[model samples]
Target: MLHVISQDLSSFNTLGLRSNASALVRYEHAGQLPALSQLAQTYKKVFVLGGGSNVVLAPDLSALVVKVESRGVRLVAESSDAWLVEAQAGENWHEFVGSCVDKGWLGLENLALIPGTVGAAPVQNIGAYGVELEQRIQSVTAWNLQECRLVEMNAEACRFSYRDSFFKHEPMGRWLITAVRFRLPKAWKAVLGYPDLRQHAILAAAGENATARQVFDAVCEIRRRKLPDPAVLGNAGSFFKNPVVSPARYEALHKAHEQLVAYPQDNGDYKLAAGWLIDQAGWKGRRMGPVGVHDRQALVLVNHGGATAQDIAQLAQTIRVDVAARFDVVLEQEPVAIA
Candidate 1:
């Protein structure tokens, strides 16, 4: 394990928040888990830092921060129905999806350009376009800090539910995901259900016979056009989760505003577009000090420059309150904050 005291974490998070951890331990291999477990036992509190894409970090963290940097990818299993591929926790998520598509292992094309690491995918149940990571995940392997051993959990055991899973509920640092297994089907179909995907020129040209690579390219292009790059303008993609409402609630909202953008869920609920809500609430392009809602995409809250986590939190709270008051629906933040 490589240890550093007063580690600077400005570049660690996609939000580009200037933060520091009292100590940071980075391990690149599973063989270092035993030592990491010992340190976890010694510390009063521990936090796992991944690609730093989907997080809001405090200026100073007083806990031990473990940076999981393990890396590897391989074809683990295959059958007539599907191919099981494994990726280490630290692997770049977008790159992994691209690789799978390149190798003709289709199914993850709709999730192209998602930020963060492979290990972080299951934690957030990361989804985009028309696909969620849970739909493709086969299993997850992690080092259990409390147990001081490795553990594996199948997809069902992960308890995935819209933008959440068992990993999110567990105490921070309780489990350090080492790798993830994905089941990609040999027979693939394009998922252009979303209006953006359906209307996109690339997919529109391909019609019903769009290939996985085309879908991947379309998703990437759409994302680039909609979302601001973290490198150019620091932001964690979508700042809030789409609020799912009952049919009655959806009806009320629809009656109130005919232009409300929403999608029906399999469980007879309606997932309201958080971006539409925020935009209608008159927060788009609005700024509060150094942080503001991205002008192009209301769902994104960007750090204008030199913004603190507190600033982002306050702005998010204000937006939530305004949205709740305006629409009588609550907006939940997607990024996990660490203080």
Candidate 2:
């Protein structure tokens, strides 16, 4: 357990927003749980931080920030075709995906280059290229804050949804995910859930001939081209999730607006493409002050240098309001803002 005071959060958070914490604690090991718990109890308000990817910090922080940094990987079970692997929270998600690629574990390769820690994967139910982390998750090990005990929850119990989980819903802030277990196949089907990936795979001859490594490389290349790196220009990948609505509502919109793009969900719902709507709303590459909508991906709001958190928020709100006015759909942000 590492405790530090007056730590700067700008560098830690990818957005580079200058939010100062009164105190910050780094929990890098599972064994340090007891000490961290005791410290949490001592503090009035506690906030947990992981990859610093999907968050926008307020200018002033009112709680003690605990950075969950636990790190490791364990292969607990194995069979001829699959393995039950556990990874500590601090393990960089992309690095872990690379490791799985090296081992020929097939589930995570398409999600390569996704930022944040393993523990955060389930929280957002992080999805890309037709694959979500929840589909690969076996279970999650978390610290129950109210009970002050460590507990394990199976995949079903996690109540996975698009960019959501049990931790994000019921009894919010009730637990801190410590480690996540994933059961991946050594030899498996590489699902091209998204049409774009499917076409890309076909172009690369990614049918039965493509290996997991090729798929990972191809997906990473695709993402690199589609999404701007926040390290270079400030922006979160897809600031808002694709909105899921009833099939009837989707069809209604489709009939009215023939250009609207949507994907049918398994449960008879339809996932509306937020990007297509935002781009149609004429926000792409539009600049205001220091913030602007990314030219390539309108769903992403960019901070084109000297942009403050408020400026980004304002621009995003404008886009949301415009989209909402044009279509009857209300936009929701994917990033968690702590004010």
Best-fitting candidate, measured by TM-score?
1
lDDT tens per residue, model 2, 161-255: 88988888754455789999999977787776677776784434757577778788888888888888889987767888888899789989999
Model 1 over residues 129-240: C-alpha lDDT tens digits? 8788888999999889878989899999999999999989999889999999999988778888999989989789889988889889988998999999999999998999
Clashes of 1: 0
Clashes of each: 0, 0
lDDT value, residue 116 of candidate 2: 86
In candidate 2, which residue pairs clash? none
Candidate 1's TM-score: 0.98
Q: Residue 107 in candidate 1 has what lDDT?
A: 96
Q: Which residue window of length 10 is worst by lDDT in model 1?
A: 1-10
Q: Of the candidates shown, which would achieve the greatest lDDT relative to the real structure?
A: 1
